[model samples]
Target: MPRQKNAFAHKKNTNENNQNKNSYQKKPEVIQEQPEPFEDLIPRIERLEAKFDEFDSSILEVRKRMEQYAKEREEEKRQEELERVEAEKAEKAAEEAAEEARIAAEKAAEKEANKESQKENEGSKENQAPEKNSKDSNKNKNSNNSAKPFNNSNKNNKNKKRYK
Candidate 1:
């Protein structure tokens, strides 16, 4: 029975090999495309090269415009920085001027106060000088009156002694 199975398998393999051989013999024909003529392709190649050149020129123009834009932006930034610095300087100057004005006002106020105090001192000194002079004159008059009474009493005593 094993020998019979082996023979059947051998027959199946041989049939498959025969079918593969027949398929190979009946292969489909391959059609080859002919290359285009050089004259016909030259214009097409030139058109492609022209388009490439146009693209390259457009790219260069864009790069130049971008560089110009960058320079413009840098210049604008520098202008803005200069303006900011000037504004700060102006503000600082204004602050300094204000401080100077405040100091000047303070000094003027102090001078006015000093002038007022000096005027008050001079007025008081003038008022006290008159009062002091009046008091001294009164004292001198009282002393002179007391000395005249003593002289009159001594003269009266000498007259009484002569009459006795």
Candidate 2:
């Protein structure tokens, strides 16, 4: 009977040891490992942020310069267009003035020619009046001689010399 009791006790002890070994093989609570934060890493991140800010400022400055250049080019184009228009207007005015002057000069020359023709007509009339008077005097002398007998004025002169 004593031998049976001791054998039972040894079996129970063996079972307990097997259960402890199985529990040790697996962890009851899991431990998570985290990396430690370093002081140097913070400064590196700050430097990267500063470089991004600088790049943004440079892009803004480039945009502003491009806008200024566009405005200047537009102003120059407008000025050139205005100058071309002014030149065209001035040329048209000059042509109009020259045409007016030519018309006035032609009118003056025509008037002078008319005056000269009128003067020539008056001179011809004066010459005709003198010719008419001379022809009338010759007709009167021819009629008086025809009315008397043909006598020589030399016979009268001979009689006058005998009397003296």
Candidate 3:
């Protein structure tokens, strides 16, 4: 029985060896090197973080400049609106002044026409008074001359007979 058991075990061992040989051969594994530690990568991380911070600062500066430009644009718009309003008001005032001047000119022209008509009336009245005075003086002189009109000299009178 011991010789039979020894033969059976030897056969099992040979079969195991044969099965292992029939499998695909694996390539020898090279010794893999370990990755670098965090202590070695700290400087690179710090450099990348500093670059990120610089990018963030640059973006912030750009945002601030954009806001400043927008504010300046708004101020310019406000100034233009104010100037437009002032120009409109000035134009309205000028129109009103022109209207007032037109009214005043019309009044002045009326007054001048009235003064001219009054002067004409006064001149006609003055002329009539002088003519009336001259006619009255002529009438008085003619009446006085007619009242003493008996001075005559005649040579051939029958009532004055001469004996020479």
Candidate 4:
């Protein structure tokens, strides 16, 4: 009987130890924190919003600068193109002036040549006039001499007939 009583007490002590081990193995409860109040988060949100606005302004400024640079480049190109066109026009004008000068020079040369030829022809005509006058004088003298000799012969024939 005492042995039975000691066995029962041992069994009760073992059951208590098993319960303690099981309790140690159980998962602990998770502690969840409450969300921050909206009022408390307002300042932080404002700060973030301010940072975004600053970033956007800087971006806009950079964009404006880029647009200004592009416009300046376009203006420079336009000015250069206009200058090139003006240069071409000036060159063409110069060429035209030169061509006109050349033509005028050629015309003057032709006029001078014509004047020289006309002078030469007049000179030749003057030289031929004296030769023609001299030839005509010689012909007149020969005809007069021949006519006088014929007249004398006829006179002699008439005198002989009268004497006969």
Q: In candidate 3, how many Å is residue 152 off?
A: 74
Please give the RMSD to the true structure for each candidate, in Å: 22.0, 25.3, 25.1, 24.0
How are the candidates ranked when ordered by lDDT, highest leading?
4, 1, 3, 2
TM-score of 2: 0.50
Residue 85, candidate 3: C-alpha displacement in angstroms: 0.6
lDDT of each structure?
0.89, 0.85, 0.86, 0.90
Residue lDDT tens for model 1, 1-164: 45554556657778779988899788697988867669788989999999999999999999999999999999999999999999999999999999999999999999999999999989988887555558778889888887554458778999999999
* TM-score for each candidate, following the candidate numbering: 0.52, 0.50, 0.53, 0.49
Better of 1 and 4 by TM-score: 1
Better of 1 and 3 by TM-score: 3
Q: Deviation in angstroms for 55 in model 4? A: 2.4
Q: lDDT tens digits, residues 33-135, model 3?
A: 8766787889999999999999999999999999999999999999999999999999999999999999999999999999999999899988875555587
**Backbone clashes counted, model 2:** 0
Query: Candidate 3 overall Cα lDDT vs. reference?
Result: 0.86
Give a tens-digit lDDT track for model 2, residues 67-151: 9999999999999999999999999999999999998999899889889988988988877755455777888879877777778
Best-fitting candidate, scored by TM-score: 3
Worst window of 10 by summed lDDT in candidate 2: 1-10
Model 2, position 158, has a per-residue lDDT of: 94
